[model samples]
Target: MISDLFAKIRRAFGDYAVDKRLLQEAEISKLPGFVAEYLMTEFSMNYPSDWLERLRDFVKRHYFEASEKEYVKHMLVERRKIAIIDELRIWVDLEAGEHRGIIPTIGEVDVRVPADLARKYQMAMITGMWGLIELEYSPDTAKRGPNGELLENPVVVVGFKPFQAPTSDPEILRDARQYFTLDEWLDVLLNTVGYNHSAYQTVEKKLAVLSRLLPIVEENTHLAEFGPKATGKTFIFRNVSRYTRIIVGGMISPAALFYNLRTGIPGEVAVRDAVVFDEISKVRFPNPDEIVAKLKDFMESGQYERGKQRVTSGCSIVMLGNVEVEEREGAYVPVEDFTYILPKPMRDSALIDRIHGVIPGWVLPKIRQARYHLSQGFGIALDYFSEAMHTMRKESLVGEMSKHIEVAGNITIRDERAIKKMMSAFIKILFPNLYFDNRELEIVAEFVVEMRQRVRDWLHKLSPGEFPKDTISVTVRS
Candidate 1:
């Protein structure tokens, strides 16, 4: 049954496209061998274009053609931008047997062959076309055997540690034996994505609004996670889906994201799934003016026009990065700046008001666990359900807190959409059984209010001594 199921899935996702079966036909070769060759022969063809006349269109397409491990930097000129980049050599270590723990190590492998090939690798990185892996070698010459000759076996023996996939908890499945509900599934998902409810005050703070982010991601656009490093901000976007895409850090520019029309038009990556902004605070461009403008329109209206093409892109934009922290448990970001101050173009109040909810990463404690074990019976295929829930969320996603809890009369919502998102997110977090009374509702509302307030106050702190005079205005008076 499992073999049949695997075959069905293979057909569904088109895993055969990469041609691993042919390698397996011999001796079941390791995945990296094929991945490497695929990158070298197939991906290495893309490169830094000629400055002589027209910019080559094929350069940008090289990104998607390359395998994972490449990073892109934006190169914009005359409204025609091309992402130029270098590949990342990813190294990960894992506990062999159960594979419950994933040790992600960052580094690179450099293969130098004169000056021209180096430029080719750089172009691959800039455009998000291919992954640059960790390599350490000198191109000067290969090793020689005893007789002044290049060794027959020239391959260097390098031991590498790869990424570890956490084992599904046996206990969580055990717990699922007790109930058939979405909450149980959420518990598993929360665990799979490395969210430990015990460590962070975030879960406690927003117990009121926990369930909003559940459901599957059915969209084809993009997902970006930009935040301060190590907040687990990127974890959710990265680990959640098999089909969901993730862009880490380095060079994120207009051309890498959208299109550079100097030659033929190249497509942006996030046009399908979510676009996560990692270390978003570090997203700096030579000229912030254009990048800033694009962010604002996209965040608010989801409209991005590159060159002569105007595309109504659909994707969730999640920006997370580390904020400079001075205090122990202060918010990493600011509230007033949540939407508006994120990027300069995002600074417009009208645009800022539309943000669903700025998640407070500062309040979220750092992640520390060898491996995450989800609650029993939690559904592993959460992305699919999340997509289904998104449709349901359109109408059913309203906050039902008022029915059970009374607002303090002080809490006011300038953005009705935000209020709805808070309420819905709360439901999603608390899902399985969302039926709640006024007491439960009140607790949830406090979380909702605190979450936004926490974001706002943190933003205030970023400004020198610009703390709010009466910041804690919306007290969750149950």
Candidate 2:
């Protein structure tokens, strides 16, 4: 039965369907899933029988480890030119009157890029782009400081081949969703994210796992998920989308999150679709008052002003943290207030209140290799899947809520908007055709309400005076 379903998925998606096992077999786990899959598909189509060997060779040659930075630079200086596949970011040096590229693997930040190339791929200047970049070493092109000291590297970007989807059309994903039942669609989502659907036993569990994607598919959505470690919270964010920037445990400066006052460059929140704060409890804000103040404004209104720049972005904020969980009556439950898991700067009631939803991450099972946690069946290519979700952000299905659902009880305006945004995201992912009946709408409404209610519950626990116990009720219109 499962094989048949996999066959159907392959037939439906055609070239967009990639066998997830290929990624492991090729030993490209270090690369993002989208980039790995894109290389696999491209090589397989171009080199049939020896595609695996060719793909391995391609990765070995082009992809460089941080340790190989000196070697790569040596090759560039000796050979005068070298091509490498890496996440390339471009930033203009106004003082020098040149475009600079940051190739992370090679640890070269001052590599020069042609103005035309920068103009062509502007996103690289913003959030960076993964691509095959050819660099040439030209000693004459090197800049000199006023004191005649060498000011920058001589490496110049000569060519680029971006590793992105050929086209991004959400309608393709939407049209495809209609062919599968809700259960099958859920499995498809799981498989697409490199999970084995059969390993997950229940629909609720599957939905719990899928809730991690809410911030990705929705605009200006703020979410928090805390549970025991190893729940694959960071894995999905890292591998699933290039548009998401994950900041591990460290001090988060206002410059990094919003805008760099010195560089005149927008930060992660302005460039990426979602900014995930992994291990939130350990993350520090250098200027707590300043950073938290700006964060609250951005989370609430999607607008932030740093220095002379006032920027508006639809980027969502997701906080992931580990918490103490106890098994009570055969169910894992959080023993402490969820807010306690956040860093001190983020524990403000006003900041917490701005969060739209809280995912009960304890419900998800730990990912393990022996338990068949990885997908073996066919799934959509990550590059394609990421693009589809990014494109979906431009669409708003919130109007559907007012058309079909009604809120009851003492729900705050924030709670209502949160519920509506979440439900709309669910509808966009599950029922893009907007053809669901009242029963389906009610189920989705209830699920999203529970998500928002979790936020309200946390608020009540944190500041009972400010946020009293309130019931958020929703019903599908008859």
Candidate 3:
């Protein structure tokens, strides 16, 4: 029955020409419906097959073609040129003492780029920046590798856009928001994150909203969410945006994350929109104090120094870990000291204070077979929605709070800042184009305050004397 419902939903959205079977073949069907559709739309030619290998063979065979037009015509007919339209993430080959874009599939290819784009492309390669480029494949250096070894294939960059948060127009934003009612918009947003709106209750839907939106809506947003395993905490950062990198369990270094002074290279934080630390409880850092200090500074100020270079970035940091929740009466509640599950260094009061939101992941129900979305409702295509939120990040929605709401006077500046940032992000996510009544604003603001307060409560629990009680509250001033 569920499979039949999913097929019907797929057919309804077939006007977009998405390859639904390709998703199942690629084993990426668990991703959000919109996300799967977006991927298919972009790389439809490659669907249900390893098209990269096919592209490599085409480039190799056509290397000696006399007529460019004839070769391109062949590509057009064969669906080969479509590869150039979809952006691919490739590494710049520095091992050869010359710059070359190395497609993992077409190994050791001589990468060619236009003269005008050389500088920017080179810088991106050196800085560990994700280069989303449309390649012009070539077999020019098929005879020799960069190290004078045998190289069978080479490629060129015909067009490119450095992987960064894309922006959307205000008019488009206004027009898009106008199409959906409040509940419908929420449903769309939830489904965008792979939640079936009809499958969950009202509260779960709301939790899904905050979970999906919190990371995408702003820079320097610090979030920590710990739940039972397989709760899909890593999905958005992993699958939603091209401008995100998820670092799984490892001993992460300040040099790797921020900047490497010896090599004069900027790190992940310098480029990606959101950097998630997955299984953070198990992640070990060599210099805990240095990481904690630098992270604290960066989370607050959005800047960090390595040796002589003071690099700045707007990357949001997300920490995802697994936790064991205990049942209190009938409901599942987080253990009394939730902070104890985190690494000892991360439990610092000052460090905890910097976190904008600490999600109550335990409140979320464990995923079952039926939890997946099979909804008939429409949602923004993943790429468009991601770009819209990226654009919305630049706007100052925090100012809207002053006109309609206020935080308690007892709240510290940091607390207020966290609340305002979280609330503003919620507004951008839930009500883009800044369209919402005072009542709606108040309700969202309260949820934002509560999330922030959870961090505050944890801080006080960890250090009783240093942190104060929960006198702070969010109120609608008008």
Candidate 4:
């Protein structure tokens, strides 16, 4: 079998170390087979030695673990290298001595703004960084034609206010330098649109949320979140980081993220830092397969194909929504059994398999007036962290636990090494150098299974009535 040979090539060639030009050759003479040989000996992942398996194995393997293997797969795709440090050099101009707090960089509004959207934004802003306002634009915004053609115009904005301190006392702004930590400031920006809570207290509790969102945000692209309302789903898109740029829902067009715009510029979605589709269940898919089918390719292969153009838009996506069942106990269906709540497009079993994670939104407490806080001592530089993490992910240097685990039979973790690797790496991301108890590892591991099961259960439900309440459809026997 070519598995041994393939692994051999990878280990020797540094697992696809050469440039793309050298990777493609008419003859098999040009490659190193170390890693190829390694693969053959372990999992049966195979490839032609002449061509770079990273590009050719799109069909051979698909699923990736969020642990170590996920990180490995990301390296194979290899994002375009950027001089992140050199870019930071410009910011040095703003620093004086040991570095005080940084200012939020605001994107200037366009000369002509849509009034409906502007109104909603202003109203949302009144909540002072804790309310979420989502606007859907008319399709005409995405039009390209011979000048004047009528297009659909339907713009709607939804505002969800988060619990925030009532007074605009704005005391925190007097001297931002005195009372904030870098991380706290960052949370302020990200959670700015959500309901108000004590920035100091809630941010500490929500630190895990930031760690979880960081990697996904780094890999931003087309993503949709749908479910029961009030999860504060739109908060991150508006104020979190510069990497994420959002447009309202109603105004979306296929071409907005794919084809050329009215100005002949490729639409924002085409090169979206990241696109978030909130209230996703409400969005009707004209061609359901447009994103769904393309997503399967992007997730599996890291390449998106539309027309003659082949673009590598490396993005990790997040979808958030409430589970439908009411909290009441007397109902025939436990909120958990109510499958009708899942987004219709997500009803496809195959599509469900492609998703990496679907975090449960039910766990977060609802915003309450009593929970609001007036001021905070510290915060983070969101733009800096967003950009920095994006750079670090490109290094393929982050420690991951899945590396040691084996994925031999039926694609579950058969390798004890892989399991350990995942736990260690996961904890590293969260705890870093700090000490954690076994209980922590156990909880994290369970979370992983829970995420995987969510996808599996949804897939099982797609085939029709009466799926087993608890059994998830996965090939892994373990």
Candidate 5:
């Protein structure tokens, strides 16, 4: 019956059956279809036929390819060895004017793309994109760094094909309701994020889960959530879309976020659909005040300037971090006693006010064995869904929500803008076909208002001196 449900959408997965025991152990089925496919394909190829026994032995010996070598050779000079990398990321060094390709599970390799290949995939390479690259790799010390340190061995790319997003038929989106019921489509959307419909038993819970997806479907949005660990706050942005870029833990510079003055090229902000800063507390900056200032301006207006070049990006920014919260009398209380656990410089009211919506991660159940939704349901392919959302971002759906809803008079203009942006994003995600009636529209509007209100409530509590005492309220006009 489960097979029957998804039979129409299932891909022709190759003959190699995934090890049943391994699948359960790795919890691969809990992942999105694409991610599961990738793992299954890779595991079958790399592990032995008796992988059950071999995997146990491999784990006993602590043989992880990643940790064995500091900088492992994922891409090799030999023809047979080079075939392993299905997708590679080519990094362009702006200062050196050199190119390098990174093979996942391994470190960086010096890249030399032929002029013709470079010219052909110029846009992709310039944006530091992922692609299947045919490279001639060698271990010889090709060049040294500015500090005279030996750089990794270089690889010459002989050929390549950049990954392209699948185009959606307008008719398909227009008539989506005819093909699938509303619940089925919502489940599919949930599946894209590795969630099982069964896990969320209520509509509010489902919408809360869906709120995390708003950034993916909306442009120039600012969203943040701080709460318990292991809630999959950063999972969708990392896995579901290639259009998104996730910075795990590191120091971020203005040049990296916006534009590099020396390179005269726009940064991740200009190209990526969603840029997620995971572990917000751990992400350091050279100049915190300066970066926060620029980020606030950009998050507010969707534009930024670096050096002499003024750059604009449609990317949504999301910040995810863990905060200590405990249950007290059926209510969650912040153990840290702070509105957010972000960097000290980033905790300002001005910066907090710019955030469109804040999901209460504390309310989200911690991802455990039972919570992981390894599904048998059919869903849109991650790439296709990503493209569809990106295309949907161009449509002006803010007016749809604005016509029926009005914010409290005390709410500032920025508050109104934040609420409208959030409402527009939710509409695109939940009602893409624009088929909802007034009652449905009211429900959606209130959901959006509540999310924005959560952000404002925190800002007011955190900085009562700066923010108004009268909290923001959304009224749906009959």
Candidate 6:
């Protein structure tokens, strides 16, 4: 059955189909799944039988570990010029009147970038880009200080080739939806993110896993997921999309999340499609009251201001944390109230209300058994898949949603919005062609309402006065 399914996926996606095992076999596990898949697809097409050898060779030659930074630099000095694949971020040094490239692995930040290269890949200046970069070492032209001492690194980025698809059409994904059953499509999505669909036996469990992707596919959809450790809550967010940023437990400042007042630069939220707060329990907000206030404003309107600089971003927010769970009738469930899952700073009712939904993370199985859980079948290349979803975010289905569904219960405006946004996301994920029948719409509506209900329940628990006991329901228009 799995082979047949793989064959079906290959037929449907054609060049986009990728065997996830190749990523591991080629020893590119250090790279992001999307980047590894892109290399696999590119190499296999150009070098069929020997693609594995070519890929392994490329990684060995071009990619370097942090420990090998000195070796790479020495090579550049000896060779004058050398090419490497790395994450390159560019920032303007107005005082110096030039753009500087930051190669994190090599720990070089003052490497000069050509003005033309900076403008050509503007995203590198914003959120950073992973690509093949040619660095030229010329100590003869190194910058000198007022005291006649060297002031900057002699290395400069002379050429770059971004490791990304030149163009992507979400219409291809949308149009291809007609070829698979909804269940098959759900499995396809799971496999694309490096999971075996068979491991999740129930449709509800599958949807629970896919909910991690809501923020990536839909704009400004704030979500939270809490469960026991190793449940794979953060895996998809960290690897599936280059547009997603994950901040592990640490002190978070307004400057890091919003606009940096000192540097006149927009933060992660301004450039990425999604910014995820992982290990939410340990996440700290310095001056909690102030940063949380800014977060509330941004979460509510997608607009923020700092130091007289105002910005608006369509980036979605996601929060993930570990919670205590116990076995209940052969299934794992949370031991404490969901309201206490967040840190004290973010425990306000106003902020909680802004979150669209809370994923029931306990339902997702732990990824302890890799051989059985990891995908071994064909799935779409992550780069192509991520780009497709990024493109799909621009196409809103709320108008189409209202034509077929209605929120018909005691609910606030926020509740209504959350339901519509989540339902629209589900439709975009499952039935992107927008051709689901009434029965199909009802199934999706039921799941969406349940998700929003989790938030409403949390709100009720947090503040009984503001949120009374209420049930959110949806009616499929006949």
TM-score of 2: 0.96
Please provide, for model 6 over 106-172, each residue's C-alpha lDDT reduced to its tens digit, 9 standing for 90 to 100. 7987799989999999989977888889999987788788887878888889999888875568777
TM-scores for all candidates?
A: 0.48, 0.96, 0.76, 0.48, 0.79, 0.95
Q: After aligning candidate 4 to the native by TM-score, how far in Å is the CA of 50 from where it should be? A: 67
Residue 162 C-alpha lDDT in model 3 = 44
Clashing residue pairs in candidate 5 (N, C-alpha, C atoms within 3 angstroms): none
lDDT of 3 by residue, 349-451 (tens): 7778888887777767666553253333344456555666766777766787667678884688899888888877777777776778777777777677778
Candidate 6: stretches off by over 4 Å: 65-80
Winner by TM-score: 2
RMSD of each: 16.7, 1.7, 7.9, 23.6, 5.7, 2.0
| Arranged by TM-score, best first | 2, 6, 5, 3, 1, 4
Order of candidate numbers by lDDT, starting with the best:
6, 2, 5, 3, 1, 4
Comparison by TM-score, 1 against 6, better one = 6
Collision pairs in model 3: 110-154
- Candidate 2's displacement at residue 360, Å, is 1.4
Q: RMSD of candidate 1 to the true fold? A: 16.7
Q: lDDT per residue, candidate 1, 1-478, as tens digits?
A: 3233233333432311222222222121222222322332232234324321111232233323233332321212122222222222211112211111111111222222223333333323222222322232322255466877853222211222122112222232333223423333333334323343334334342332132242223222112222344555655454443223345545566775766554223344333345666655455565566666776667666687877877665555555555544354544543233333254444444333334445554544554442332111112333232233334433444445334433343233543334445565555445435544455555555556555554444434544344342333223233
Question: Count of backbone clashes for each model?
Answer: 79, 0, 1, 65, 0, 0
**Model 5 stretches astray by more than 4 angstroms:** 3-81, 84-106, 126-128, 138-153, 161-165, 168-171, 178-184, 262-265, 328-340, 370-372
| Of 3 and 4, the candidate ranking higher by lDDT | 3
lDDT of each: 0.38, 0.86, 0.63, 0.36, 0.65, 0.86
Ten contiguous residues with the weakest lDDT in model 1 = 97-106
Deviation of model 4 at 17, angstroms: 40
